[model samples]
Target: MSLVSLILALLVEQARPLPYRRVVFEPLSRLADTLDGMFNAGERGQGVLAWVLGVGGLVLAAGGVFAALSALNPLLAVAWNVLVLYLTMGFRQFSHYYTDIQLALRMDDLPRARQLLAEWRGRPSDGLSSSDVARLSIEAALVGSHRHVFGVLLWFVLLPGPCGAVLYRAAAVFAEHWSRRSEDPAFGDFGGFAKQAFAVIDWLPLRATAAAFAVVGDFEDAVYCWRTQAAQWPDDGLGIVLASGAGALGVRLGMPVVEGGEVADRAELGTGDEADVDFMQSAVGLVWRAIVLWLLLLLLLGLASLVGG
Candidate 1:
């Protein structure tokens, strides 16, 4: 059942990707905002409560629906799983930005590429070079693929039903929204809770993603970088994905970039050639190959289960 639902969800997502702003996610955003207003009392306990209500409420609701439908018919449960996964998982959610940046770089339009990168990341790109843009783009693609696809699938398979996927995505959204420094001062305490919660949730999935990259790409180098450089990045979750991806691609990533006349020195990762326009395609290929590997593993497991039964 898990294998079939995942395969179907991927196919549906590939055929017709969901838009960035959709009705399904709008209510989730509003719910987060509501929770913030109601429970963000600038206290640690309030923050924990808000995180629980925000993440747990959705998971329970989805699980309830799946359970009710499953009581009626097993096919209904499968359909529900597909719908939830389709809404939650897909490469196209972030791939368009990657493709646009690649196209801009290929056309030798560094400015345009920088602008696209800034738009995708919601940050300033004042003095990013062509190499900087390429490296950041590839890094973003790798991390986004993990967050938007592999993590969701892994959670869905781990838990009883679609609830796991919903939990993973909701926690991620909450963490990203609240953990930023630009938010209201009251949210600082709240943001810490969300950030820590997401770290716990994402811990295993990030390593799983790194392992997939290692298996499909350069195993030894990916493992070496995962051990050596993953801790160098500030966020451990993103560090694992980016470090392994950099090694998988056999390219150098992370350097100082002048943003608004400030040079922010980033930790050096991987070892080899510097990133270029052409490596973007390699990154995309790496992600697809990892997806294929995941599906094959699931298929084999399903076959083994059937034989044992």
Candidate 2:
């Protein structure tokens, strides 16, 4: 049922992508803000309480619905899973930006590519060269794939019903909203728990994503980069994904780049040719292969369980 739900959801999403911001993000962002306004007191405990109320509350509701549907009819539970997965996981959520940027670059339209990249990442791409645009787009695509697809799929498989999917997505959104406000005087330690809690939740799934990339890509190079370069980046989890992805693609990433009229220093990851439009296309292939690998594994697991039963 899990495998079936996943496949159906992916197909449905490919056929008709959701308006993600309107459907999921806006409501969730409002909820996070409401929780912060109501519960935030610039204390760790308050942060924890808000996180529980936001993320845990959503997870409980999803699980409860799934349980009720499952008790009434298993098909209803499967439909619910498909609907949740449609809302939560899909390449179309981020791939349109990537596709447009790739097409812009292919046409030698650097300015358009830069604008697309900036809009997608919410960061300035003012001074980036073609190579820089390709590098950043590939990097963003890799991380986005992990976060939006692989991470959600892993959690959905780990927990019953759609609870894991809700858990991963809610935690990620809360972390983004709450964790980065540490420098705000009014926020103080209220975001501390969100950061720490997401770190714990993301650990295993991050590695699993890296490992899948390794298996599907240049295995030796991916493993080598994962060992030697992953820790070099400031965010270790992101580094793991980027290093492994760069290695698999045999493209260089994470070097210093000019952004906003300044040189933004960055650690180098992978050991191969400089990133280009070719490598960006390669990245799409890599992500698809990884997804295929995951589906195969799920299919095998389902077959084994049937045999045992």
Candidate 3:
């Protein structure tokens, strides 16, 4: 049932991607804000409670619905799973931006490419070279693929029903919303809690995605970078995926960039030549291949189960 639902969801997503701004996510965002407003008292305990209420409540509700649907009719439950996965998974949500950036770069339109990158990332792209644009676009694509596809799929397969996917996506959204450094008093003290919770949730999936990159790309280089360079990045999850992907593509990443008069120097990852417009296509291919690998594994497992039965 899990394999079937996942396959169907992937196919449907490819056929018609969901809207970028989903109505389903809006309520989750509002719920996070409500939790922050009501229970965020600038205390550690309060922040923890709010995180639990905001994330756990949603997951529980999703699981309850799946359970009820299963009791009424198994097919209805599968349909619900497909709907949830459609909302949660798929690369098209972010890949469109990636494609636009790639096309702009291919046409020697550096300014347009940088503008697109800035718009997609919500950061300034002033003074970024063509290489900078390529590297950052690749990095963004790799990380986005993990959050939107690999992480969600791992959790969905691990836990029964849609609970795993819901939990992972909810944790990611909450972490992104509340974990930023800020000086607003109403923001409360949940940033640390949100960050730590997401780290715990993402720990296994991050490494798994990295391993997949190694298998599907340059195996030895990917593993070497995964071990040696991942720690250089401040965020552990980002470090793992970026390092692995850079090595896989054999492209240098993490050069210094001047954004808003501030120079942010990132740790270098991967080997060989620096990224260019061509590597953008390589990154996209890498993600699609990873998805194929995942689907193949699931197909094998389903076949094995049938044989055993």
**Which candidate ranks first by TM-score, i.e. highest?**
2
Q: List clashing residue pairs in candidate 1.
A: none
- Model 3: residues >4 Å from true position, as ranges? 22-25, 185-188
Candidate 2 stretches greater than 4 Å from native: none
CA RMSD per model (angstroms): 1.7, 0.9, 1.6
Residue 240 of model 1, lDDT score: 90
lDDT for model 3, on a 0 to 1 scale? 0.87
- Candidate 1, residues 65-171, lDDT tens digits: the string is 99999999999999999999988888786688899999999999998998999999988998888999999899889988999999998899889889999999899
Put down candidate 2 lDDT per residue, 227-298, tens digits, no spaces. 999999887389999999999999999999988888889999998999999999999999999999999999
Query: Ten residues in a row with the worst lDDT in model 1?
Result: 179-188
Candidate 2 lDDT score at position 261? 80
lDDT of each: 0.87, 0.93, 0.87
lDDT of 2 at 27: 85
Residue 123: error of model 1 in Å? 1.6
In the range 1-309, model 3's lDDT, one tens digit per residue, is 888898899899889987745655666677888888888777878878988887888789889999999999999999999999998877787788899999999899999998999999999998998989999999999998999899999999998899999999888888877765346676656567887888999999999899999989999999999999999998756899999999998998886788867999778999989899999899888988988898889899989999999
Measured by lDDT, the strongest candidate is 2
Q: Once model 2 is optimally superposed onto the true structure by TM-score, how far is the C-alpha of residue 198 displaced, in angstroms?
A: 0.7
